[model samples]
Target: MTETMREVEAGATRELRRYAPLAANDNREDYSLRFAAVSFRRWRPFVVATAALGGIAYLADFAIGASIVLSFGFTSGVLAILAAALVIFLTGIPIAAACARSGVDMDLLTRGAGFGYLGSTLTSLVYGSFTVIFFSLEGAIMAQALEMALHLPLWLGYLVSTLIVLPFAMYGMGAIAKMQTWTQPLWIAGLILPFVVIAVREPGRFAEFASFAGTDGTHGSFSAVGFGFGMGVALSLIGQIGEQADYLRFMPPKTAENKRAWWTAVIAAGPGWVVLGAAKQIGGAFLAFCALGVVGAAHAVEPIAPYVEAVRPALGPMAIALSALFVVISQIKINTTNAYSGSLSFANFFSRVLHRHPGRVWYVLVNCGIALALMEFGAFGFLNKILGFYSNVGIAWIGALVAHLVIVKPLGLAPPYIEFKRAYLPSINPVGFGSMVIASVVSIVAFFGAFGQTAAAFSPLLALVIAMVLVPLFAYLTKGRYYLKRPNTVAGPDVPAALLAGTHECLACGEHYELPDIADCPAHSGAICSLCCTLETTCGTACQEPGAEPVSLGMPTMKLS
Candidate 1:
């Protein structure tokens, strides 16, 4: 090579090396990688799974149930909850299994499933937005509780609830897991006490609640249109499975001895969250009915009023204190997951688009700041409209993703294993990207009443149906050719397969990474980590030929020993 060309190559290699270990020593805990491959002894699968499942204990279920019941009658509200649960559970099973088995986060899984490299960036944005929206929601609920108990202003409570999660979320999964586990028992006790006391002390209330008519004059009757709209609102929560997968990715590798426990953890912590959530929603509806007389129908939809009423007969004046405590604890648990997961999503997104790694901690702050802003702007007041619109996009994204994982891969139309590495994937895959876009646009138009009230009520269902159908159709049309750009050529005898089993040091920055996070970079002439690969903008496809095999650069391979 000429002297000028040689100088350019040297400069590029140095830049590549500098990007490799951007956050090497940082306490990622469980922020970025799918399978961090930390010692199983340090975090048992069962414990981690329990912590993950416990995040679902937030009181938003109560508010959702009450809102639906007040809008629709009890029967229609119950049916909607059941319908949403069934869809969430069915869709969640395959996603949970795929994520746990492959040890990849949702964004990584999206890339491999069908979206391809840059195609999944939109999904990262969608998923990240979910976190902020829900974080604001849960924070708003806590703020309401604060207003009731301590006579604090709602605005200041919003700030308190939003900021409280920062210190814990910054530590990542380890801190989150411990907090969830520690607080779970108290939360469960607080949750059940009011219900048990109410039922035992007042059996006649059940009859009254069941007979109560909603404000819409449904008189305990079911409305198909109302049921569909309620289901759409509930279905907006389907993206929560992505948060479950965030923790499931850290599950200990399934083994022969602990296979049963592993499956139990995966099921309970995964789709099983919806089962409990559905029951909680029903309970909330019941509580709202009982409190309708006390709080008046206008304020009945708020969880604080119902919860305070439920325990008032038992705890008397202490009811607000206990209720506020429960709300604060519950919101803290779930919001931490929200903040942590949002940071990871933002990291994946900007790392790819901006070609830089500023550490997941920075994104944690950004996600929280956005959520706090949303809360300050009164997101809670427009809960229905916001979630109703967001549900279409969330369902479309998950529908296409689940179909790719469950149907296309099984039918052999696409690669069975997820191909997440940058080198092995294309920049875009038409199946996932095209399907999501078409589904979102069509459903959104219908949601705005272009197709009448009935069609608008069922917009989420339309998005789900369209995306699911299109993914398989597109897979067949493309013959799955775009799934992988090339086979993974990073693994070989030179790099002991055992090294791939645990952590391996990147040849570029000499930073350690779990197997899933590293890939061979012919441009750098070594094993490059994913963050490093993402930050490299000038490699110019030096890693592979157009259609043939990956060309090796004869660089010395790093030995694990």
Candidate 2:
């Protein structure tokens, strides 16, 4: 080989090494920007489901429940919580099923479902924002516990809470699964203890909670406006399905032997998260009510204070210490997830936008760093305002995605199966992306009270409805031509045993990837893994054009004879 050509090959090898699979580094990356290969999906369905379930162990539900009841009273708050949960559950179903079946993360699913390959980057930011915002909220809760138990400054507590989860989150799913599984028992015990103590020591408090007027002094009875506003706040959590799918993508392929377990795990870990989430919110409302007189309304919404007060009767002096430990444990379980999923979202966003990916571990620091900054600024203080505003945008994105998956695809308006590869997709697809934009703009206007108070209160509901209608409308208008730029040339029934069990060698990275992760690259005249395809800037999306010339990676295109 010529010396200059050898130098170019070496440089290319180093560049490819940067995006190589985690096995090259002796730590599995859990496939941040690529398809979850069948060979790497070693966890059983139930185990994967349990790990996904563990991410919801945050104390945010307590605060959300307490805030809603305080603002809307018991009648409106409880009803609103249920209403939001119902919406979240229904929307979560199709997303969860698609991710599990296709072994793709939420971002990849968005690319194929409605948002085109490039258009889904917008949702990546939306999903990424959800993680950082919640990470800050959860970290603030842990900081409060630190201040109460250890006498640490809130700033120091924020740093501790942020830094503590980095090691666990840095390793991805393998470490996360173990941490979640080991901590599951303790977290569950801590979750139930305060409620159990209140039930026994103050039985009447539960019954009296129903009649209590809110601190707002006007929502003593159910008000439609109050319910709508409260539901909007609750609906902010709709983006959490993204976090759930990050884990569900790792579920072992469903088979005849494990079909029951597979379906059960998917449902329970997917939409069923909201079941426990709703119950925790109600529990938070009840606990806040019990502690209202002791801690005052301002402090009642903080989970640490209310939980400490609730268990004080049972454990006497030890309540403070145990509750602090519980808070710390709960925060760790969730913040790790926030950091982990946030890194995935960030990785996906930057990889597509920059055509470069440093690694998933580096982005964990970036995610936690952003969360720490939010905590230092007192994110906990304005929890309702932040969540309420975020709901309109979040619901629009999720609703459009769910519509494409459930409605457009089923009605034969769009593709029958998910196509996530950039090689076979255009830079933008109007079906999902257009719907989300229209819905978000309309709902955001409503949220600002442009229409009326009632409209402002129910803005997120408007976003969901509009997005659902627009997906099919846009699909029909465009004739679904925008969904795929090219037909599958590598992994389909036309190729025997396609994507079932074997691996293909990627020409750019020179690494073997499972069939699902491999695509025939017109630019390279060989198979390329999804990550390599995503990181290739020089190809100029040639695969999407008919009879396009082979474009090399920063070198002249060489046609192999």
Candidate 3:
């Protein structure tokens, strides 16, 4: 035993030295490739909140609303917005609160929320796909504006729009926060200016909008089927909360001095994004209604045409320039977010699956590359079909996640606090994993018309319901045993609270890591960072005693000397 202990110590020392060079520049890395540890989470609450909410100003909401309005008319379109908003708001509250409190990103939150370590990888893929799809959609919108304003070829415009966001997203949260802050005032003014002008100058247009029949011949009446279909399209934005969570993770740790600010930031930047988004959708519907005659039905759903038409009455020939600028600005802001979040998602997914993380920056390029390809493929042309199908999987993922966080955890069917580190979690947790699978399969089938038209239209709702129901059911059936693979043993009353909340030198990497990222490594008989733990697949189960319950490094272990 003494010889074995010596060997472990020597091995740990060598490992630590091996990573010393990388550890020296750790601060510059922004914790992007790994957990956002406490020490690195130094941004102010309001700044992070502003950055998060800024991404919500995307013009895609306008396009989404206009498309629905064109298909379902004003009444059904408005109803769908309201229904989707309610669901998004309610579901988003708990998720946002939990993520903000834990200071973990959506990927980490999903890990502890019932989808175990490897299980959550599936969700990472799903979330990553959402980012790429939206990135392409938003990029395509920008390209449209560029094409209109500069008369650039569509292909060139797409390339320009897609590449412009690379520098902003490359730097991650710090740069993103600054960019969002700088553009917030301009975006808000631009977003509301045309609407205000139209409301005042063309009061009759509002009345005209109310009575306008859609191209689909839906008239200005609500149809249940139409509302259901529209709701599904709107619900696709539910995944936007995941992007929001990515920013919320940067919120400063809550303290008595900033408690109010923290909660405000959490609420405003979290689910509160939907509040602005819902209004934008409704505005888009009205704008599209106004533009129907000028731009015709075919171009009505395009945000550029509607905004240009609205501003033309006021700004005259400059309408094209101003609207193009607005679209470009909006697309840049949202696409940066999409690319950044997608990079994080892909980083998380690939790190676990491949056990190799080149860097977050590398994945940024990968995400943009995929989205660029999607743009070239004309993803924007099939917006409804794409979002409609994607919503099923997205809804299922969020539904299972929220159910675990709000219901299963509260009921003691799972651990209350999020345990994200790979060492403490199983590779798969059926409660969330199985729930997502079942919900996704069923809803996707319904979406593809395996069910009747009404059911097909309401596939996203079905996904949410099914996943929400299954999560609790699975938790109860499994007795929540899979929630944690071991008891947390690295954090407890025995360890100095300050030490747990402060920094520690990782035993394997010789890197200074925040307490949340540090875990006791029994193999090394010292502290190891979560990233090192994840990468050390050859360590075996040396951390646990034979036949003893696996103890997580973050919880109480045998008292340190």
The ten-residue window of minimal lDDT in model 2 covers 552-561
For candidate 3, what is the total of clashing residue pairs? 9
User: Which parts of model 3 are misplaced by more than 4 Å?
Assistant: 1-13, 17-28, 492-499, 540-561
Which window of 10 residues has the lowest lDDT sum in candidate 1?
1-10
Residue 412 lDDT, candidate 1, scale 0-100: 94
Cα RMSD, each candidate: 4.0, 4.5, 4.2
lDDT of 1 by residue, 233-332 (tens): 8998899999999888878778899899989999999999999999988899899888887898767877888899999889988888988998999999
Local error of candidate 1 at residue 96 (angstroms): 0.8
Which ranking of candidates, highest lDDT first? Answer: 2, 3, 1
Clashing pairs in 3: 487-552, 488-555, 489-552, 489-555, 489-556, 490-553, 490-555, 491-554, 491-555
Q: Order the candidates by TM-score, highest first.
A: 2, 3, 1
Q: Per-residue lDDT of 1-561 in model 2, one digit per residue for the tens?
A: 001111156455323334434424425477888888777789999899999999999999999999999989999999999999999999999899889989999999999888998999999999999999999999999999999999999999999999999989988899999999999999999999988887887789888999877986777899999999999999999999999999999999889999999999999999999999999999999999898889999999999999999889888999899999999999999999999999999989998998877778878989999999999988899999999999999999999998998889888987777888889888889999999999999999999999999999999999999999999999999999999887775664354553346777677776777777778887677778888888887889678677764333221122222
CA-lDDT, candidates in order = 0.82, 0.88, 0.83
Q: Tell me how candidate 2 scores on lDDT.
A: 0.88
Top TM-score model: 2
Comparing 2 and 3 on lDDT, the stronger one: 2
| Candidate 1: Cα lDDT at 297 | 79
State candidate 1's TM-score: 0.92
